[model samples]
Target: MNHIILGNSLTDWLIALAVAVAVAAGLDAVKAILLRRIRSLTAQRASRARGVAVAALSSTRLVVLAILGLYAGASLLALPERGQLFAGRAAMAALLVQCAIWGDHGVKSWLASPRAQQAEDPGRATSSAAIGFLVRVLLWAVVALMILDNLGVNITTLVASLGIGGIAVALAVQSILGDLFASLSIVLDKPFVIGDFIIVDNALGTVEHIGLKTTRVRSLGGEQIVFSNAALLKSRIHNLRRMEARRVVFKLAVNHDTPEPVLRALPGLVEAIVSEQPQVRFDRAHFNGMTAPAFSYEVVYFVESADYRVFMDVQQEIYLRIVSMLAEQGVRLALPAQTIHLEGRPAVLPVPLPQDERVAA
Candidate 1:
């Protein structure tokens, strides 16, 4: 080996390099052993602190050791001022990169932590993922800015410029951003979730997907209806799936000529029919007074389920039974009719002649 190289003796350089390598290896080995012990001891009692420490330490161990070793080895040789400065900057950049990696890993682990999972409200997994992604992006952006600053770039102006540009970009995509935020609100607030039957404005459908900018719904007609999340939030949303019971109001009309006793008994009869049906609660039945051609009755009830089909079935059964009972009782259902009355007839009538008689006839 050459005795002298780059103004340092080869032996001395080799010793310094060996010392740096030994120190790095020793540090790494110690970290590994300590981490292993800690993990073993806390395996059943994993806490937030332990999780954070593990995530931060796990990703950048080798890179950090390499950076330390490189700096130590470089210090042993006689290098120009510019070269030393460049080496320092490079080390700083590597450190920043390692920090970014550590932050990313830590964030991901935190997001996937049992505590986070437990803390999340039902149906908020997508919101958590989105939050994690945004945090990571911000973390890397900070890391990049630090790297550029270490490399002698003026970061104050750059930060200002970035802030201004971000505002402009935000304004340009305000609608899309609004929808994205609305989607996050939907996930977190949980007005509705996947498989929920919802009615928005005139559209009725089941929620299928909640995306960043839009919610996709499968309508009753078997077609997809995509609505902007912002607009959906703005509109009134009826989440039928969350209903424990459904209120039903129906009207029945009987012929005006029907006996008053039957009209008085109509409420009791309807209530009995409603009570007999399974999963139904009779609310009230009333003689709603007389219409032009019929005696009107109003019936109110509750179906003890959120299912539309079940409600329809119960209603149909009630209708059929009511018709059958009324028929058995010899009562008549009303039909719409008009009754016109004239107090007097026209005093003079001019009869028209046949078309063949002409004007003179």
Candidate 2:
């Protein structure tokens, strides 16, 4: 078929180019349709990432078909190195398969795991996806090394040289590697998972994501704080999300005009109010003694819900009831105030009735 007819001594290059383009286009269409069918079948069962990965790998079939078509056309035209033409195609397929493996296995599975379940962050997710892609690249290095060795490259010598150089390289990145490994520990130990409302040192936030070398926290005020995994692993993390209930303690001032009889009755009233609440438990209420312009009673209770709004609602109801009861007993709550004087008219009275009065009486 080496008949030089269409031009000045050439085997119809225009026809070859047209044929290649047409074959590539046909292969691309076939791949698109085939992937749609395969994915439709896998849609009901496989995880999203895995399904996408499978589809992506299937699409690479077009490249394979196009290359085969080219080789076939070339062979008919008596082209050179036809055996090695298929070698490059095989390598390309291996590379694609490697990527598919990472997307399907390493990354997608981690994303599917409960340990990685976090509050959605558009930016943080993009960052995590980038990191996942990088990890896959590192994994691809291993695959590439294997493929090179299979192609008759000297692996042992190459690996030895790389190992020597990698030591120094590793030294430079030791801190990063430490954090990465710590992140892995975080995933495995799972002392605190994502979406957990945690306080690490002074940083309080809901966990946004756990990444390769850092854990991201989205604060209550809509700020993002990135903590190194190493520091996070060592620090004290108070996970409020895991708490069954939150303990709240505060002092409610009693009216100075409230007599000792009413002050004594106050504890029972507070207890009754707490008892009526659904999830609030009464602790001891202490008559914490007289204060500046007011007598203070320390009330302590545990709320059943960790929700801040719920705690506030319960607190308001309990206090409102206490105020109504105090009014019934002719007691008004004392406001914070100070007694100013132009001159010292009279000294304050000493309480607890000095023991000397007992003997004198």
Candidate 3:
């Protein structure tokens, strides 16, 4: 065995191993300091150093573990110096890149999780999650390309081939690609979110699932409908989820013979019903011109909630109260009727019919 000894008995190989370990430790410390400075500068934090230190400590364990893996791989190649240099360097590069990327994603996800955030706004939370995922994907892609180039691969030639292939693939799957792109746009642009009720073309439903090719919706008619993302993106979309209020309009007609006092007080009575309602907003009430034997009035109000049941309840309450109020005011509802007068025609017609029958007898 060719073994190195310490002091008088120590040899060259032990010293080299010690030197490599020292170099790894120093590099790790320096990397931690550099990352801390970079994060501080970008985040504009001075007192956040402790938090950075804590994050680095946790991340360092993962990093150190990766370095250890590289060193072990390198040491095994040490039998041949020239071959070891190339093999060891490549392995070290791969390990460092993988670990760094892993740490970045790990730290960011830990921070953005609801468990980490003290207070969260839903809009900000969703946006951050989406952006974070995209950023992580891009970072890894860049790292992968860099590693390939380091391995002496012809990146330019590869890119060219990929581009040509991509064109053909794109042409073949143009419709599918369009839908995928549209889904990406939906994620980024955020016109609507999950659970939103929307109307697109003849389809009206709640958003159940969003996918690359198609978006699934559950219609109010107890049916599920699937739409191509490209088609849904092209259609005129109406989101009822964002509706502020619901409006109701109806006409009421009172007898023209009703008292003038009741006619004048109708607006105030209608307003009272609207104002007292739990979630109704009074818009207007007008005494329109007489229609034949009745006087017409148009009433309009808004329901505060988009809920159908709530709107119906408010409307029913108002209707019952309005009917009672009209009764109290002695104003009756109009009904269709006709009056006819018969004069002097019955006697002469009956005698002529009877005379014909008597002659036959």
Candidate 4:
């Protein structure tokens, strides 16, 4: 047999080939063992951390092992300097790519975690997806820059250009980016959730959908109100759904001529009326004070439910009962009125100058 083949001794070539084969086979065996262990662990206790680690490690095994084997074989071969440099660069690039793949897998696993799903507000899956996409983009961008630098490219200039371009792009889409960030904040902070009744400024509605750039609300008037997420965040928001109970304060006015006994009984009447209603907890009822033309009474109560409809219904029923009770007692609701007096001869004798004018006419 020839002692040299392709400028390398036959013995060296055989040894290098055997080493490469052994490394590849050994890596395959290790991969199988690790996969088996991961499966067993998952079966015993499924956890996000375990899944992420396994996913990251499993995705890159084949590529990493191949690169390592190739590197070992290349080192043994009597190759030219350029060939050696090219092989090294190739291996590095492959490793970088494998690392990016693992990062992607990890990100996906984290997004799918039970904690993330439970803690995130409704529609947070979309936000997680966007975040994963951005992470992957950034990872690949860094990997590309590193690869280019290793290949003798002027990466400093390239990085500077990318920076400038990114700045310009950001400036151009500042509004969109603002809304995007606001959406992310909404998901994280949970200011409100889907089906929540919210009032923003003068607009009142139920949250229907929360998008990346806008939030859709179904208003009381039966139309959809769409506001940019950034602008919506800027407005004062009243999340009615978060209220544990509804407090209601109302006033009642009766004619001042009402009998003193009826006036005294007014508070008890109001309390009784409120107590009779379901979901209502009476606080206080008192003859608060006297107004210009009536005696005023104030009533305070709370509705056990946060539902606006329920509150209104209970209030209406209470009002009806109060009106009925007052009618039965012959008490009348007060209306606005004022009294005028003709003091001292009609307050100037209806302008005495007018008498002179009338006589002349």
Candidate 5:
């Protein structure tokens, strides 16, 4: 049968069909082999690159391969000029779409890989969600532009229009856009992360979640506080969780008439008390000055812990020991007192006296 259809003989049409099917089946077989090999390599070495390759290959659809095979078959035919051009464009579009799929799979695989999960900085791992989403968006946008270009579209003018429109939209939602960018900066710069104890101005809390628009903090008072990312970044943040040690300074007073020897020994006694406490470093203790009511002394130390509870416990123990030492040394803690003289009369004392006259000699 020498009859021709669409400028190709019936036998030629059959041969092209056979080639298309054979090519599709062969490609599918090769994909299976490559996938298996790559998976084995990924399992053995735990490499993110190899794992991404395996995922990308796994996403290779049979339908896409069939479309590619059809495009290859079309090359063997005496197609019209328009038909040939359309076939080439269709093949290119398919190829671009397949590449986009592979890229998407690779990005997701890399984000979920063991290496990412095991990163030393947990901020990097947590930031992967936003990073992956952005990478996929760019991948698809580029693929779409490539397809449009392949179809003989004037993408340059289209891209220019999109840029103008994007600028207009950005201005319209500038507040929202600011928050988004601020969130990106937060994740990348990592001033604080989830579970960090932070004080933003006066609001103190543990960071619960970081989102594109806001960050949620669970406050010490058991209420949830939400801060807009843009506003949050503008405020001063004190990340207490990162503190290596906590400094403590306290003041005590002694009676104005205490013996000089005892007053001098007081600093050394306070130093010994602070040094004996666990997780504490004694900084200094001094009789700084004398006030009208008492001789004031200041003591300073550092707790080698960021935990508030530990600091409080160590401080309580030190205070109790200081009181015991003062009692044993017969040091009287100063109390406010005053003496007044009535003309031609004994001075009237304001200081409290137990079972004694209200007037002073």
Candidate 6:
């Protein structure tokens, strides 16, 4: 038992190995017991913190815990400087990676809370998704740096090199980067969201998806239109879904021969038709002006509903009523016609002589 092996007595080696195994077993038992308790709590009443704890604990690999135990036991041994350094670095790397895993789980659980899932408030949902992505990237980046530092890497030099290389990469993919940032802006600014009916220039559609590079819209024609996020942000966007009411203006024309009294009563008649319609507010009706061939009246009203179908139905009903009213009043709609006066005698056509008469002559 007094014989030395690797600078330690055989008995000392056995003690160290026994301690490593004991610690590993203890950690495994503890992890299992804690998991059972937390899971029970989760089943009783779910919470974001508890959910994150479950996810993080589940990600802790048995091998990582065993390595940690071995490192603890090795600390008591009289190992060489290099062996000690290697063990310490290995343990530290495993710990950093485990912490990163926990952080990742926490971020996902936090972002998936009820507040973040509100579809009615799309700005919050979009912001949460983007924020979660950025946080995970930052978390992993820090973990990588810490691991590299433990391995005795000179990070300052590496970071400076990456900076120069990053510039080159950025220039190569500037347009893609522009679109990514534009997508970020859309999430933050929230000009439009999924299910919003919007018009971008001549293209009108409902937003279906917003992505890093493009935004997809389902058009009225049932075709999907894709727009680059950068270009989409540049164009003017009309979010019709946000409108409280639709303003409608229409013009009516009556023949020039209409009676003066009938013309005077036309405005009130049309106003009555509009006011009687459901979901509409009549604004004004007036004898606008006399055109070359007819008298024109302009009518304006508002449809209280933002739905296009509702507006159209209301408009159609009002028009039909107006036509019926005009018929009752014995008024005819104007038609395009032109009148001209002869300032000189009208030209007469001469009759053509027959061919036989010309031969006899």
Please identify which of the two predictions, 2 or 6, would achieve the higher lDDT against the true structure: 6
Candidate 2 ranges with C-alpha deviation above 4 Å? 1-37, 40-56, 68-135, 191-194, 220-223, 252-261, 286-297, 332-361
**Clashing residue pairs in candidate 2 (N, C-alpha, C atoms within 3 angstroms):** none
| Weakest ten-residue segment in model 2 by summed lDDT | 114-123
User: What value does the lDDT take at residue 29 in candidate 1?
Assistant: 91
The residue pairs found clashing in candidate 4 are none
Query: Would you give me the overall lDDT of model 4?
Result: 0.85
RMSD of each: 5.4, 9.9, 6.6, 6.8, 5.8, 3.2
How big is the positional error of residue 10 in model 6, measured in Å on the Cα after superposition? 4.0
Q: Please write out the lDDT profile of model 2 over residues 1-361, one tens digit for every residue.
A: 4656423235455566567777778767876777677677776776665565554555364455666556444444434464455555564555555455645464644544332432443333434564566677787777767777766689999999999999999999999989977876776567777677899888899887878888899998998999999989999989887788988788878767777888898888888888899888878788987877899989888999988789999988988998788878888878777777678568778666669987787
Per-residue lDDT over 17-77 for candidate 6, one digit per residue giving the tens place of the 0 to 100 score: 8888888889888989999999999899988789888888887888888898899889889
lDDT by residue for model 1 over 257-289, one digit each (tens)? 899888888899889999999999899999987
Error of 6 at 331 (Å): 2.3
What is candidate 3's lDDT per residue for 16-110, written digit by digit as tens?
55665766777677767877676667477544444544454445554554565446534633355665666566665666585665556464744
lDDT at 354 for candidate 3?
Answer: 77
- List TM-scores for all candidates, in order: 0.78, 0.65, 0.69, 0.75, 0.87, 0.88
The lDDT of model 3 is 0.73
CA shift of 256, model 1, Å: 3.2
Query: Which regions of candidate 4 deviate over 4 angstroms?
Result: 1-6, 9-22, 61-68, 114-137, 184-190, 193-195, 208-212, 218-224, 255-257, 275-281, 288-296, 332-361
Model 1, position 182, has a per-residue lDDT of: 93
| Residue 35 alpha-carbon offset, candidate 3, angstroms | 14
Residue 184 Cα positional deviation in candidate 1, in Å, after optimal superposition = 4.4
Candidate 5, residue 348: lDDT:
75
